[model samples]
Target: MTFQNEEMRYEQLFRVTAKFHSTMDIDAVLEEVIHTLQDVYPSFSYTLFLAHDNTNHNVIPIKEIQHNVNGENPAVMQAFVTGFVQIEDRIAEKQSVLYAPLKGRQGIYGVLQINAHNAIIFPKSEIQFIELLANTAGNAFENAQLYQQSKQLIADLQLINDTSHRLNSNLRLTETMTFMSSQIKNSFGAMEVGFFMYSKDSLEVLLGSTPFFENGEGEEFVTFSLRKILKEKEPLFISDLHSDATFQNAIYRSMMSVPMVQGNEIIGVAIVLHESPYYFSFDKFKLLQSLIHHSSLAISNSILREELEKLVITDYLTKLYSRNHLEDMVQLSMETDAYGTFILVDIDDFKGINDTYGHQVGDEAIVQIANLIKDNIRDDDIGARWGGEELAIYLPRVDMQTGYAIAERLVERVATYSNPKITISCGIATWNKENKETFQSLFHRADNALYRAKQSGKNQVIASENRVC
Candidate 1:
């Protein structure tokens, strides 16, 4: 037939091919394929059968195809109208059923069978037409498969990228690793997740339920593990803690461990747990590696911060409590109503001594005073440099009378032991019940009394009460 006689052939263009290519629209492709067959050869009846067998990779079936050209023919609707099959040998011998292997040169995709009413649609030319349809249909099916593969790959890539972003945004080690665990579980349906760190002393990373030390059956083991991370430097993991039949009782299946390591030492571990197989893929492993590396950096910073925090609260000069530390303690005392005696001691005529013998002697004087008083005070007492020559002490559980007695002893000790003519005067105050006083009031009253002692005789203990000469 020439183009003039076959002018309707233009209508057979593959619109169903377009539907197959659309992402997440697999149903659209199937419906369109059956609909297309109905449009062509309106003589018999139709139904589309897709292969569910793995013989030819389940090549979709285009079958039982019918068309109503005259409208008097009721549509033939039977199950076995058409089918596609995978036969071992390729042959062409047929009088009852027509079979065309859905094939390309590479391999047989499947088969397509065309059935019709008796011999009304089974002529030699109609057989030729069915073969032609199968050939073109092969290309369409391949396109659909390719579309599905591409869509899945794109989704996986997007998920991996999103996991990366979420892990990077936070530097908190625990939170970051936990986030990775959740992502892996959601993406791959893994069960259970945890992080573990290795130790050089302990050597191996214990997984699942066996406690390495005593008191570790429940809370103690978790505490011991995390405490080890805090106390030492090491990295480790125990993947498959529940697998291998050894840890099945613990309910652990599979696991992955990433260590937060710094240089030669390991800080901690990031762990993921599962109770099933295939918990992780190559993508999951790579994600864990990246996550662990980031974890190491963040954990290192946390360690450094803790050290710096300690230093910030300590005085470098006298190795005593810094002003900031003292302030915090006072605030805590204020809030808790912790009863304590606050003694403020000042070197009498310390500036005159500095002017006479120089700052070196002044420094020596302060040191001598600190040693003498600290040695005499209770071990639980808090001694701090209230500023330059002034020193303060917090004696917990001591009342004003007891503080006054201790202050007298300090004044006696400092005055008698000094090489120079310099002497120290002290003042004492306790937590005030009437005022519901904070450390601020106690400190202020002590300061006032110390000044009075200095003014009265410059070498005696003058507490906040009648002067004890």
Candidate 2:
């Protein structure tokens, strides 16, 4: 309280204020606050209660403000809430506690507590000095936070830019989604990522989704997300899935689901998850929205492209491969495979069915036979509409006996399963690596054998003789 002591305090305050302004680092500012307080008030114990728990200072006595906790110190909370200093005197303990708000122009960030041991009161001048130091620290903290936020914003923009560029590079749907999944996992530290595409009013998990979704463990999450995204048509940021009544036993605590929207429609959803509660910040949720928005158009384009490609090679009525596609498959099989079977199937008396029941019935009979062929063939086999009322099946790596048995099975299935009851004549032709026959030759032989089956019987299978020209 002497004139000399007041001048010295003023000088120290000026020096610390300059130091606080010299760096934008939050840790440095916090350390300076603690050092200055310790140097000036060595007799008093000090603690800094920050609003957020992100800062790290091992030596400084720092704790998070428990705003909602019961039985917390009223003086500290009051100083933080009111942005004013609070003083309490404990007469029985012969001590006084002072709580100073770390107030900047924007708001109060924390409370600075000074416990004066063995004292019932603090001098007015000392309280004023502590208040000044607390105010300086608050301003420095605000500036450091702004600096860090601006840097993060720049990085987020760069991530969105990179993702958008890659997605627009004409990558297929699977490739684009896989790249996006990797980017989100690495950037957000997510434990799992999934991409779901809307198909025929339902959501189908894309290939790039993590194995957690494919293995059926993520069905609940998918169903929940699908319902919410479809109903709300907005992104979801769940801090803790376990807190929800429906997901009481959820393993993932944090979740973010952003709908991939194009124009007015939601094409799909991008979901990110983490095991820790409140793992994703609000800023990250916003960034995810931006990333999905930029990538949605590219994804929509890829889906449309794939659909168009499918239509090009697919038969419209039967959903089988077109004759051109069948030829390509047979040629590729003959070049690479050791042996293969080609079965040319013909509906017996197709003209009679058209005359009796109409052309629509004939088409139905053809579709029934195509479905039977699809059910009986392996996934690698190619089933095609060879022509009107005629279907073809190319089974790669199949030998002569297996091919004849498959043909016989198809002949029986068509006779039994076809509506309006129609039968098919099937001709089987086998080719191996030794027979250097063209696709045309293979087709001619199958067609000849099919003619023989039709002449021999209306509902039977015939295998072509192995005669290489």
Candidate 3:
């Protein structure tokens, strides 16, 4: 080669290296490498095999090295593994193939193959130039990869921050899980997301899980995940569920199962699934672990808050609503309902039972009556422990006749179902929009009717005199 020609080649290499250093876009860097080589050596063909499959330059001959079939290119593998250049002289084909490792300071990123048609051997100077170009491309690729990864890390942190803030805003458990499911579906492209809470020794599918789990279609996955999580107490990242012997026919190929941990215990498991194999990357699995770790405490707090609220309005012994809660329901019903009925029930001869059998037996009698009231009433009906030996039921939108019938049924059920058999007296009252009755007036009428029933006979149902029955 002439001195002028070598100097010109050096100038081109210098300019391309400067261009590579200026831009952090990986595809642009890769394209520039191929274009520079084509300009310098038009007779030779070039192909770049990258370790990561993120580039989208259709015009450039770029392939992922990881996807290469075994035994296809032993020289390319050796160059990547040894971080050195390799040469293969195809004497029969009268061609020389060169493999140059894209070696960065951190690691090798890819292999660049140069095919010299009709050349038996590549000169040392030509190999040196190609090696320099490959090294420059490798450094640029690493820098671009690191830049993209940093941006992704920032986005992931923002997502976790937003989710943690929203979850801690005292949202209900159902709402929190729903928000999380939506976030996972949008960010990770998950097909199904499920939150399964541990209750006692069993797993209970929570409200925000997809219908696929709630309807029993995903029971096998749930059981498998539960068993693994319970034993390992660690997150699972599965590339192909079908690869496992137990899940050979599984429809979902990719899965991530993270334990919702609080302290040392795993309270629940969060599962995300996809139908395509290897859909979720390891980075995504790590991000999910972080998300669930931060959200678990908030979930636990929400659950505890709901349970505490329930306890506030419940009677301890009978497990019925307290008198205050009954009053609130009655007040709300009177405002919204067209008409409603209130029944006040008292255990017959409760003082006699206490005197004869002890207060424990009397308390048991009150609980028995409370259970009977619950069994006979609709779910919307409010059953409360009014006081010692007295209980109440408020049936919203129910008329006088229906209320009387319910009371009569309770009277009979208590007599028959109560152990150490007992009877109950009931007084029923009805109110409608036309009557303009306040909650206080409604309760007074029910109390007055109860007095009348006690006077008439115990274990009988009576209604306010103004009402028919």
Candidate 4:
């Protein structure tokens, strides 16, 4: 190499370094690097490709464009994986391709590829300069990537914080699930979103946005996906469900099922599906994992709240409405219905049965009578454990005759079905719109009738009419 050429190369290298250092923007830096390389060799075409995730060992190009060519060249990939400059000589083609790894302080960030139009010799000095330029560009690319990742982290944290606050704000479980599903679908632009509750007896799927194709087949696929995840107890992602033998007939191309894991147990599952293959990114999947992780706690709390409320209003032993709940129901029924029947029933000789067979058998008898009342009444009718050995039933929109018949039938059923041959004495009272009866007044009338029935005989039904049959 001549001193003149060496001095010229020195000037060119200084200019290229200064120009490349002018921008922190990665794309601008790459453009400058490629342009500078072109200035050094005008007959050559240059290309640059970078990895989507620097943490991932496998190098896959996030960007497809490379100079005028469309796809990644094997030589460029080889250079990137090897972390070296690969010189491929093709004498028959009369050209050589140069693939230079963009080496940063940590690792190779990408590859810088050059395709010469004709056979050319790269002096040792010029190759060293090219490598130096590639290294500079690689560092700049990494800096930009780190900056972007930090910004993304901030955004993701804000989203999670906002979502947690919204979800935990005293919403019903179904409402919370709906809100969560909508948030995920809208944020990710997903084709389908489903929130499901998993239990031994019940498997419920709440849909947020309908998919492009949904029918019986879609439902079957959802069930299959849910069962698969529950049995495996792991997250599932299928990029191409249609091609898989397990789901070849399904319409969805991509699916993601993430369990709502709380501690060691899975409380539920969150699912998102798309019509196209490879629709979700790793970042999106991470966000979902975080979303469900946080939401699971909220869901479990909501379910517990509902159960607590049920305990407050229902009798734990008989599974009947408690006295307070029945009174509330009576008030509500009076406001809605013009009239109704309130039947107060007492198990005949309940104390004797407890003394003879023990409290356990007494409880069994009560439960048996409660079940019969529950089974026989209309859904609008309310049955309650009014007090010890006493059960009450409120039938809305029923006349006195209907109320008497219902009470009489219940008396017969309890007597026949009970194990120890227990019988009941029932007091039937009717409420009318014109009477404007308060719940307390109606309850007193029924209670008086019940006392009269007990005074008269054990097993019988008596109406407020004092007509005992």
Candidate 5:
């Protein structure tokens, strides 16, 4: 080693060092190391290897790193071995080389190999210079890794915050699950992911995986195993299923199943998959856990909100759709396909029944009437108590004729079964292709028809058009 040797490369080394320190992109820094060293010592081909963050389940391979050649050239790579050994591998065949173990003050990150032309003499100062440069490279690599980890931490925190915000704003379980599933899939880079919930009896599984199923994977073994897990009440992970005797035909190979829990009860499980043989790592596991935990909370809150909404929209005494619920459903349904029949009914002399039998028997009659209408109508038909004595029904895809027929049946049933032999008048109005029929107009028309039925005689059904007739 001599001043001439150290000074030979100082000019290019200065530029490369400055670029390395300037860059926060770790990948660029590693490439800069290779490119700069190649300029000074082009005698033998070279390679740079770097890694950090060995304390956790993460691979902190040096960023921005490159070898003059690819991984194929074992002979050239073999030449980079010398007496200095924290690790050993020949760098190139014909040349004596130096392998410097890069480390911060704490511990080793990785080894860097610099191969010169042949057996060349090195003085103390040049050796000292290589040590100093290696120290810098090691430190830069560590700092870059820590910075990246910090960035990822920020992203996770933001995700939690964003999801919490959505819990208040979205109010729909499907939408929230979709957002959450995307976060998990993108965070872990899985080929596929699913969430499945089971009934308390543990016989049925509900697919709430990705909001909606865009693929058939959820309908397959993913659903079956989720049911099994809920029955057993546990968390399970499967590395590869290809070799397994039980589930060989269901999935191709690698998969993971994690229980999604809220409190002591296991509500569901999160299933993740990858095509490769070895994809699950500690980082992957940790990320999956965090994602599932947040998802479970989101899912639970959404469900509770839904139940509250249901409670708000239902009449406790009669179990019919309450006025508030009817309005919401009517508006939403109107916004889409406004084509339907509207039926309005008024209990004939209902004050007489309430005054005679007391409110309890009146309440029971309302419940029975509601039961009759619900039992006869399609699930698409929405039946609601518009107010104390008026009931409204919106029948999707049913015209005025069918609506009047149904109304006649309901009126007759009430007339025959009333405790005091009460009667009712009903009206039906339906939407045609006519451009003039709004939801309000339909309701008004139906109301007028009911008035007609009341005037004609009680216990009769009339269509809006029939009112004028």
Candidate 6:
């Protein structure tokens, strides 16, 4: 009968060993280990502890046990430290304990402990079986850890590649900023995301998912963080803002500020904030650095594109529209208006001013007159530099009387407002359906009128005669 009982025990041990070897999942293996030990010793209490840096007292419990061992058991620590089995049988107290070290070929990983209500001694065969179980479970845990690390690395790489592809898709600057803000907020699970353009002169923020922070107490925290980042010109990761003496008044718990730099000059900052302290990980901070580096190139390109477009349509000296842009505006105005007025202005005796005060002062006089023209026109009206000493204005939906009044006002403003007491000669012409005039015809008539103004007397207004088809 004793031989039969030993055979049955060996069979059970063999089946439990098969369960350990079949799975590489650590949690599943731990569950199987707990059940197998209970089946073998039904009257014994069991506890499984995973090794944390090889310290028995600071181990992580694998499963909840009803028979609670409040602190570190001496026998369990002895077996784990020695990499061997420990047994204590106290027959007088009716208690026994067995400690088996869960060891792999590399090293010991944890401890498997058993407590029997009745004093009992484990045989050589049972001790060997428990050691085999520990070794198998240790290898399974190692495999699981390696798999998790590989998956995380893959995910990080994918995030970087995806952000690079999207940010380089020829978006405008405003659209690019908005897209970057949304991506960061969603990816990091942040409470507020803000993109701010920080330059030597100004601070402008484009906020996303921060309605509560737009004009509230949170705004003070956001402003303070941005100023600090700008001054430092380095990345800032605050795990706890409330505890930081530099920002004691700041209410938010945590934040990250990444400077968007181009060739050592920081043009902007990207900020992410959360309501809890220590919310972001180092891995996430590194990912954000990579993302901002990729986005900076796209943002710089967009800014250059905008500046280039402005140069194409604007006159460099006068800061007014070029002749070609003016012609386009006139054409567009003609298409949609019943009556359109055109005014041509020439700075009177401009060459005499240049000859007397030099070209620099003459330039100042021209700039002053251009300012008067710009100030007198509505936003929808067009102002352009036609040529040297020649400027033009286009006003749509205006009658001849209103057009003449505007031209008169410009002549008075230029003569009264310009330094060195300069004045301008103006000519007015109108286009209407009854006259059936083209833009060139209208411009020619206005030119003729300007010649008349110069001929009659300088600093005066002249209106061309209207001709019907």
* Candidate 4: regions farther than 4 A off: 1-49, 53-74, 102-106, 118-140, 167-171, 188-245, 252-275, 332-341, 348-360, 377-381, 395-436, 448-469
- lDDT of each candidate versus the true structure: 0.57, 0.87, 0.87, 0.79, 0.66, 0.76
Better of 4 and 5 by TM-score: 4
What TM-score would each prediction reach against the true structure? 0.43, 0.87, 0.89, 0.69, 0.65, 0.64
**Model 3 lDDT tens row, 171-261:** 9988988998999998899999998888666888888888888787888888889899888867889999999999888889999999887
Report the C-alpha lDDT of model 4 over 18-37, residue by residue, as the tens digit. Answer: 76566555556566676666
lDDT: worst 10-residue window of model 4? 53-62
lDDT of 2 at 348: 91
Better lDDT candidate (5, 6): 6
Candidate 2 residue lDDT tens string, 134-160 = 998899989988898899999999999
Residue runs of model 5 more than 4 Å from their true location after superposition: 1-4, 10-14, 49-97, 114-129, 185-193, 202-216, 220-258, 272-285, 315-320, 327-340, 344-380, 384-392, 396-398, 402-469
lDDT of 5 by residue, 95-120 (tens): 45566655555555656666555444
Estimate candidate 5's alpha-carbon lDDT, on a 0 to 1 scale. 0.66
Model 6, position 135: C-alpha lDDT score: 67
For model 6, residues 1-469, the per-residue Cα lDDT tens digits are: 0112666666876786677667765666667777766676777777775564222323234532222334446666677678888888878867767777777766776778877675556667766777776666666666655565577678877776877787788877778777877788878888777766667787666544255555554566657767787677778888888887766765567888788889988887777888788888777888888888888888878778978988999988889889999898888877777888998999999999999999999888877877787888999888899999999999988877898898888888887778998888888899987777789999999999999889887788888873211
Report, for all candidates in order, the number of backbone clashes. Answer: 18, 0, 0, 0, 18, 0
The residue pairs found clashing in candidate 2 are: none
Q: Say which prediction, candidate 5 or candidate 6, comes out ahead on TM-score.
A: 5
TM-score between model 5 and native: 0.65
